[model samples]
Target: MNDWPPVRVLEAAPRWLRKVKAIILREIGSRYTGDALGYLWAYLVPLAWVLAVYVIFLLLGRRIPIDTDIGSFICSGVVPYVCSRYAVNAILRSRTAYRHILSFPTVSPNLVGGAVFALEMVNSLLIFGFLLLLNYSVFGFFEMHDPVLALWGYFLAVTSGGAFGYLMASLSTIVPALSRATPIFLRPLFYISGVFYTANELPPTLRDLFVWNPLFHGIEILRNGLFIGYESLFAMAWVPITFILVCVATGYIVQRRRLSGAPVEGDASWAI
Candidate 1:
């Protein structure tokens, strides 16, 4: 007699990666199922946003401030804002939404949250790519002067978004009432962030006031990297970077405590 089949086990790193990929696929599946528009719907949202903002600015008699096209200018700012906002919402909801899966020891909320982080980052890129094509078509020019800075800025936006997500998720674990409150906190950010105008263009009094928002810094850094003519004078690189680190550290501690303090059978503890 001989062995009819062979079994192989993956090492830890590969196994972890495999699990992450499966979780990401599961997330995508659940999100798109039964939606007739499917993936096309994802691209439409950002497009509509950019179009609406651009039109609103145009109607308000806003002139193009620099040599860059208005569409590209808005894209640089809006893309990061949209990506950051989307990431925060997705990460915040994953806890209550995936509580059943977290009961398994091998699958922690950290692992699931990491998967959501990666998924949203990919979605950020796809959505950005679609907007780039649209900008090119409408404006006939698309140039990124500093790809490295561009990428770094985009990374900061998404990471900061994830960082805030963790904070909100941790809060939801305690208050429960705030579990669905991401939108209420986030809605005001849309106007304050530099999606429609640059920091320098704002009145001196207003510029100092709005610069407090880290997303404003994120957008300014992105525009500085993308447009040669724009200088993000108000963007202090340290602010958003520090914001990301602190939020993640604090949120990680809370999440770890929650995970370790509860037994596997007590699914109620897993509730956000």
Candidate 2:
């Protein structure tokens, strides 16, 4: 009569969850260093991009693409895309940089990746709030039509980024050069993903083609959610959702094939 809990159950081994929590805490402390510089960096990256794009468009004389504040409109699109790309790059690096810890039994790719995602999300949320306040303070564009949809879109962008990062990391474990090219490959998303323009405003022919971009759907979703009277005619929520699922599955398959001799990384598969 052994009164032991099953090993597969997470409740049986708290250490799995503990390791992920510890990694997340350790990341926040080490990265931030208890200083304003780290905080400034987090906010500035997205802000700077927004300002640059806004100014360029300002000179063009039609800064307000749709019926929203120029600043808020730009922030709505740029912030999510910027954060998503950052997460993708950061998570990709985490796997290689933290290879030592990942080798430990308690630590797995998914756990480390999850910890990194948690860290990036913390920063992303702070960035979003800071920009939100800035828009309200400067441009008075605080009106939100569908807050729920907006939030869901923002989460989708970041999660899709994490999914891509996971896939890249898993691929990097095999083909290192491919991971290095991720940024260059993703650069076009900024121009085409509706960061500076919405797909809804395009002509029917162009809109149909533009709507095919999953990133565009995330941007349109966030934009529609943030602004008032801006009903987006394009964007299918299921596009990005499906894209994320595919990426995650592909990443898992890649990881599994490469590390077939042992359990897939992220002990306590429930750790994710």
Question: Per-candidate TM vs. native?
Answer: 0.88, 0.89
C-alpha RMSD between model 1 and the true structure: 5.2
Per-residue lDDT for 43-146 in model 1, tens only?
78888888888898889998867579888887887888888988898888888778888776678777888899999999898888678787788678896888
Flag regions of model 2 displaced more than 4 Å.
1-13, 259-272
Worst 10 contiguous positions by lDDT, candidate 2: 263-272
Cα lDDT for residue 209, candidate 1: 86
Give the distance in Å from residue 32's predicted Cα in candidate 1 to where it truly belongs.
2.1
**TM-score of model 1 vs. true structure:** 0.88
Distance from true location, Cα of 129 in model 2, Å: 1.4
